[model samples]
Target: MSRTFQRALLGLALLGAITTAAAQQYDYDRQEQWQYPAALAQSPIDIQRGVAIDGDLQEVQSIELRDTVATLRIVDNGHAVEVEAHGPDALIRGRHFELMQFHFHAASEHTIDGESFPLEGHFVFKAQDGRLAVVGVMYVEGEANALAGEVLDALGDASEGEIEREDIAIMLPRDKSYHHYLGSLTTPPLTENVEWYVLDTPVTLSADQIAGFNARYSHNNRKVQPLNDRPLVHFAAH
Candidate 1:
């Protein structure tokens, strides 16, 4: 079979397997036939200006946190803050989605009209309100990434049971342009109503750093959902 045909067949097989697994439960089979609109739910937050997503594209000085809910300390360009993970239990304040352990999705989860890239990172955030906000960042092959190197290095000793503390920066794209839309969690549960923000800018990753992530989560990303009726708000950096 042709390479394209083989890929399509493989994709179909994976879908079938996923469908079978999701069917053994009582929940509706959302994974089998899911779709996302080309846009997002109309929210009060201006899809254009949700927050200031700009700064010198520098790595955070350090990161420190425990796995209990995993409050990650992310510093970027000298700005430091703690990112607490509530697991699937912590409430997302206004929404019903709960926190799922944050992991990296090299290349990216969603693509631009079916175009996949080298790497994407996903910060899965679920809200009790049955809503989810996934922060997606794409990565392009380039210079050595200090921040990514640190995190990847820590993953070596990142204990399973409890969250561990590590100091490293979360580097981001210089142009904070992002695309916001409504979609579903790329992973299991495949729940809908997910508010997705695809940063227009992609970060850099060394060949070695990319290999390190692949060591653990080799292609652990869900295929892009169909943009059904969802609207996507593409924003530019200020």
Candidate 2:
């Protein structure tokens, strides 16, 4: 082969190698920059087509809470539970909208001044105006949660769509001490403008209950995101 031809071929090969390296570098950058809240930035709950009346939210009244229905299912991505709960109305900050659904996250989602916990459950809600408010509860392994314990009793297999009736009402503790912040759902299409209320006092669950739940799902928690230009509000302890 001619020397000139050989040089041209070698240059082309180098260019191809550089291009491949650049593409791989780009992918890594994307992954590194990915944030959980940025993934599920919007509420997953939606009203049924039949329930729509002039596309208004005021026309609606009450929304029933359910365990068998979910519009989105996000398993432990080693980061956060990707939720796509579907329903009609929920109650948030005293406003009645719809109780889309709830999911669990191992090792908690919010941290208190850089302190984290063992688990966190997010009860997502949506208003008619397309706003969101997430209720977060941190859990520690100790005495089993009485309410969670009863519900766990019926979760024989711990699989999705498993429903068990419990007499206890799933209500947050009366203590209003909380950490409020603006963020987004910790899942895909991570949207922003979400209101987060994290209970100051952490709940307790027995080791057995933790094991039972962990058996079904392990390490389904999202990495803590940067506070980033957002302000966190700490409510005075009641």
Candidate 3:
């Protein structure tokens, strides 16, 4: 074999290796092994009610769903089912952040007092200045949710597609009470400075609906991280 041909083969091999590495799936079971920022504000932290400070109703942030109907493009990004849409601006501690996209994680990410839920939905919003705020809604086993069913049906047998959804407001719990804290994205890079508002009240979803999602991406939740002395505040709706 010619020396030039051997070098070409070696270059192709290196390129293939790089591509494979880039496309590697996130290993949730081994997330502790993943590289993250040195910051102490990592997320999916267990919100301990005993340690949480009670705040006034005025302190509660408001999420205004301006558009009841949203055109959402859903995709199963191998890690989680992510939906791309905009609107539903959130007022968090006097700052405004607009919704960018939302995603799902099975077996809730942020636990409450060491208890886990069936599912957790993350509504990610970004400010004009590039800051991020996330609203997490927990789903418990109960009556089936219509919106959840629509999303599940749209995502059926396909990895990526778009679907229009009405009544996006139904996604949020009636009670606006929430646990507020500062944290980073649960996924790697794990960038800090994110504002998290995890709803205190959980919504309901039937067992079969939750099972439908699990059948696709089972066990996508990240283990709850340490609170690390951060002040977690519980804001009451009324």
Best by TM-score: 3
Which tens-of-lDDT digit does each residue in 80-181 have in candidate 1?
111334533322212344445345654455566456666676656555454567656778788978766756554464432223553222455556467666
The global C-alpha lDDT for each of the candidates, from Candidate 1 onward, is 0.51, 0.55, 0.84
Write candidate 3's Cα lDDT for 1-238 as tens digits.
9999999999999999987664443777777677776658899899999998987555535555556467888888878988888655666666777888888999899999899998999999898999998999999999889888878888899998777655666777878788999999988778899989999999898899999989887788988888899999888776
lDDT of 1 at 212: 72
TM-score of each: 0.55, 0.60, 0.89
- Residue-pair clashes per prediction, in order, are 37, 22, 0
Put the candidates in lDDT order, highest first: 3, 2, 1
RMSD of each: 13.0, 12.2, 2.6
Rank the models by TM-score, top first.
3, 2, 1
| Candidate 1 vs candidate 2, TM-score winner | 2
Off by over 4 Å in 1: 1-101, 126-130, 157-169
